[model samples]
Target: MAGVRAGFSTDLGGRLNVEPEVRAVVDATATVFTDLGATVDDACIDLLDAAEVFFTQRAYDFAAWYGPSLHARPESFRDFVAWNIEVGLGLTVDDLLSKDAARVRLAVAVDDFFTDHDALVTATSQVLPFDASWDYPRSINGVPQEDYLDWMRAATLISSTGCPAVSVPAGFARPAGVPDAPELPVGIQIIGAPGRDVEVLRVAHAVEAATGHGRRHPDL
Candidate 1:
């Protein structure tokens, strides 16, 4: 997200022609945030806000961060479609997580970094009160905060710079011995950075906000 731009994946994807320009604004906003000392998630929210602010002023439904991704459209863009909501501005940690998986709560960040054999993430999230998971390319050696940042930065550099990140609740994987109902679900994510997190959440929120999803999750 640090160096990502909205149009980075244009060759691979495009907005519904109607909103292409707005998508570009989001890309520019990501660049602006990088220049402004904001992290990916921080910059993303603002960029999203700017888009909603624009349309909201127009009275076009500020649901940019809150819209639906599922809709009927011209068939030309049909093949590219999937769960696309995430349209307007608003709040909700769940929605944010639905939009970006990189937004971690940092429960075991410090402890994970200092443990033996580079097991930082494993050590930390494993012991935390809630259920958690990690995606270290190497073995999970939960690193300290500094080390965790180092890990993220290094990973960003090594991987494709434009990887979109989202961490939506994947539902809980309860420990067998525990007596409590699942505390809260962990997240599932699809990494991308065209700043389309809004589209992602719009549809996701509509569904998650619906009656029974965790019971029957579908691919987005």
Candidate 2:
């Protein structure tokens, strides 16, 4: 990460419901970049339309992969999976065209952001880890998560930009006011311009080395 110009953002312009501790970890990670001789600053790319583009493409992919099996035996797949496939199957030509156009706009914005900054950093996840048995978190910080996809907007939004991103272990934190709570792992996301996977990975490697968080494993 030495001499790399890095920009970081805690949230997507207030769109993400990030937990306090999660944001703290990402903030600290940016400091690590500064300490490693990288120029760090708070920067964010506009991704307001990311959800629409991501979900639409996701649904389309799901249908392409599982539509035949779903149609042959509706009960074969889980409810949520089937629902996503059905949504893809029902997409109109105009719907696809609109989302494609929005995706193009997002790509251009990301390209522009990278012109000034070599990489963008952010919280890998909006919230701390949850119980493994639950399908997904119902809410975060009192904000309702409408569906399985809601809680993962942080990563999904980045994905929609067509940039390369890597999530490296940043640190750990416990829930507030829960003295007995176990510390949950947090990650810092490093995003690079399109086709800049090598640069993103280099930054992530530096982060992992400096923090040493990736070396620690949890007890089962």
lDDT by residue for model 2 over 1-220, one digit each (tens)?
A: 6779988887866778999989887777777888888998877888877888999999999999999999899989988889899999999999899899999888888878888999988888998998889888898889898888899999999889888998899999888788788788998888898899998898889888998889885632
- Stretches of candidate 1 exceeding 4 Å from the true structure: 1-160, 176-184, 210-220
Per-model TM-score, in order, reads 0.24, 0.94
In order, what lDDT does every prediction score? 0.29, 0.87
RMSD of each: 21.2, 1.7
On a 0 to 100 scale, what is the lDDT of residue 166 in model 2? 89
lDDT of 2 at 5: 90
The candidate that achieves the highest TM-score relative to the unseen native structure: 2
| Residue 189 displacement in candidate 2 (angstroms) | 0.7
Residue-level error in angstroms, candidate 2, position 21: 1.9
* Candidate 2 runs further than 4 Å off: 217-220
